[model samples]
Target: MDKSLILNRLKNIKNFATDTELANFLNISRSTLSNWYARNSIDYDLLFSKCENNVDINWLLTGNGYNVKNESNVLAEPIESSRKTKDPIYELQRVPVFNLEATMGLVPLVDGNGVDEEKVIDYISIPSMPSCDGAIYASGDSMYPLLKSGDMIAYKRIAVERAQIFFGEMYIVAVKLDDFSTMKTVKFVHQSELGDEYIRLVSHNQHHTPKDVKLSQIAAIGLVRASIRLHN
Candidate 1:
């Protein structure tokens, strides 16, 4: 394997789990996981399957920051930049659908667990990413103007970013400190007087109080990308 790929694989390992958790997830038993670490390298396939779709393999290997070409590359046009069909009225028929679940309480419109190919829902094929386990449904108005109750939100599992505060981007975050609940909203992370960092998960709606938390407390973070409102 190239030196860059090796590095990227290691970076992905860092995101998958704590050392112990990774060991458990791989079913390697602690001793074996330790052995692999001690050897300074791991099997390519073993590390590859463990990564979430959002992880940039190129970045992992050589710091190129290149995202893997999503599965859409083979069967469909590029997302976001796909051209509209010449015949606007020609709509695609029902596509296979999956029932997804939002383990976190905030976004409720997401499809939760279960896919029945015979029962197609909509035809918009979403390219799965390493981070994207499935879609989430919006549950509350906490993310009002940007997202509302019943709106389906696309979520991608991502490595937790502790230092950056993406002002407008919405995220599905597990606050490791306060109840460890997952909430969907805009967030900001700042420092406190005691040399600690605070995370503020906010709602666009003015009346809702922002959730303020400490950095050492976060468990996971998922970046929100797009959503589809089912209108009759």
Candidate 2:
């Protein structure tokens, strides 16, 4: 699809007056939208699902039909009926969810030439989260209220060279200690008094104290993008 055409359609939608508004309407980040524009590739299925009955699919796909559904078609439906419908499976992307406790052993399989698809214990479908390579179940209360145990966190892999951590952002980092590997949130990163770089792992629960870790101990890093919590 033409990038300009998609952007124009999005801009014309009601309440999507700004890029940020459009991103929110689509349930994605502004950076994700920027990346789409950069690649000139928009996930049209996701766009259509989000727009639902508000947009004319034919027009959206070919630019040859009315922008909105016909008035008669709208009136034919019961006024009390909800316009929302479940998105088709094809429109949703499935991501593998790995067990945090077992991820250390799984890392070698993932870092190999091919990921061992069998290592994935389960899959979660997310229609709105963008650029997620996989997900991990939050293990401890380290992130507490922000990310509780059992919450599924969508993440995107960070290249070794580009693994620089943003000071305040939450990240799923795999650290290699002398005896074992573990995943934890890197809450802060800064230089020490002697100028050596260090990262602070913080827990939202006040009972847990923050620990400093060296960059060299990190084996892999994934930027936490979106999270889902299941409520009883």
Candidate 3:
């Protein structure tokens, strides 16, 4: 759908002074709306439902035909109800995409009070996608074949106390090195032959061998939920 037209019409209907007000009316964050504008697509059904019976579906979606200001023939509700019977709208989960440059990276995202409002670059909404806490850009090809550089990795935080190590699974892991500096990487975590005190980080790339790190040095861990690669 053409979000440009839809966004313009929304501003006209609501008499909104800014896009932030429109996002608030839709019960979504400004980042979500900005993402929609950037993607050039939107959930018109979600918009229609939230607009109540004020807007005409045709006008709201395509920006044509009779609208609220045109006449009293607002058919938004009827069309909405009809579509609900045929195809119900599912609420898509919106994941905050945080910029690694903003903080120490994924570690800080899952470490403390969660998402830093200042660090959030944007929000992404995916249909039928798994629940995710936050997302960061994959930098290296350590997990190549399974992941590549610049891929968006959606992850859910693992509590420090209840950190369940699902061995042999992909995770965004952060560890403290011998120099007390933090190292963040995406790899398949395995049980270290060294024993319960450490874990093995494996790479899918054959040339890269698995390495072990002390479990005590682990600072943060997040289970990888989904991966998205945007096309130009």
Candidate 4:
């Protein structure tokens, strides 16, 4: 927010030691530079035109981008930072683990659809985990060894209405059956050879066979992001 600091950063990027040098580079008089410094006001037009590719307008205008020390790119930061900082940007997040069964009571909260946030019974803050909306305990042995019953799985909610997926990824799904029963379980959702109206649910265990059900049958869906297995 300090225009003077921004102007100083520009000076550092240009390797200009003094206000007179920067003023000459900006095609402005030293007095004009002093005037801007007095008011802490900078003419951004001169920077964009004069500096062009050398100035990283993002870092120049707002101190939001990476802090770079390299002279080659100057203000511009590479995709990857060679220098290491404290990584203050990364922080631990408390993901809500709901009481809902991984199979039955699983509700889509990624979009939070109609579900209330208060449904969260507990929070699990694990470092270096993917971002997710909530977590649920797997209800059945359908997924077996990979994701046994009672394993707490963090899930990212997704709109199951006209669901889009990268076939074969594990997901928690709520499906309405022909018997008017609702089934919620975690399984790999694969494109149904049965056609567009249906999706095949594949269980990890060999004993359980893949079943193709209508996409319309899926009432709610959540992409399984990470799982926590605890044994007593």
* TM-score of model number 2: 0.52
Q: How does candidate 3 score on lDDT?
A: 0.66
Using lDDT as the measure, the top candidate is 3
Each prediction's whole-model lDDT (CA) = 0.47, 0.58, 0.66, 0.65
**Colliding residue pairs in candidate 4:** 103-184, 109-112
Off by over 4 Å in 2: 1-91, 105-114, 161-163, 183-196
TM-score against native, each model:
0.50, 0.52, 0.55, 0.55
Write one digit per residue (lDDT tens) for candidate 2, span 82-198: 335211122245567775565552241221122356667777775544434568777767677777887888775543222235556677777775556665553433333433556
Clashing pairs in 3: none
RMSD in Å for all candidates: 9.0, 13.5, 16.0, 18.0
Task: Give candidate 1 regions above 4 Å deviation.
Answer: 1-124, 127-131, 163-168, 176-196
Task: Give model 4's TM-score versus the native structure.
Answer: 0.55
Per-residue lDDT for 1-232 in model 4, tens only? Answer: 5687777656644444356767888899999988998888888877678655444567667644533323211123223333343111213556677866333335533221123456777778775554455688887788989988889998765545343466889998878764445777899999888888888999999899999988767766777878999988
TM-score, ranked from best to worst: 3, 4, 2, 1
What stretches of model 3 exceed 4 Å from their correct place? 1-90, 101-114, 160-163, 178-180
| Model 3 TM-score (2 dp) | 0.55
- Across 6-67, the per-residue lDDT of candidate 1 in tens digits comes to 53244333444245655665556777766665676665576556554544455455433333
Model 1 CA lDDT for position 32: 74
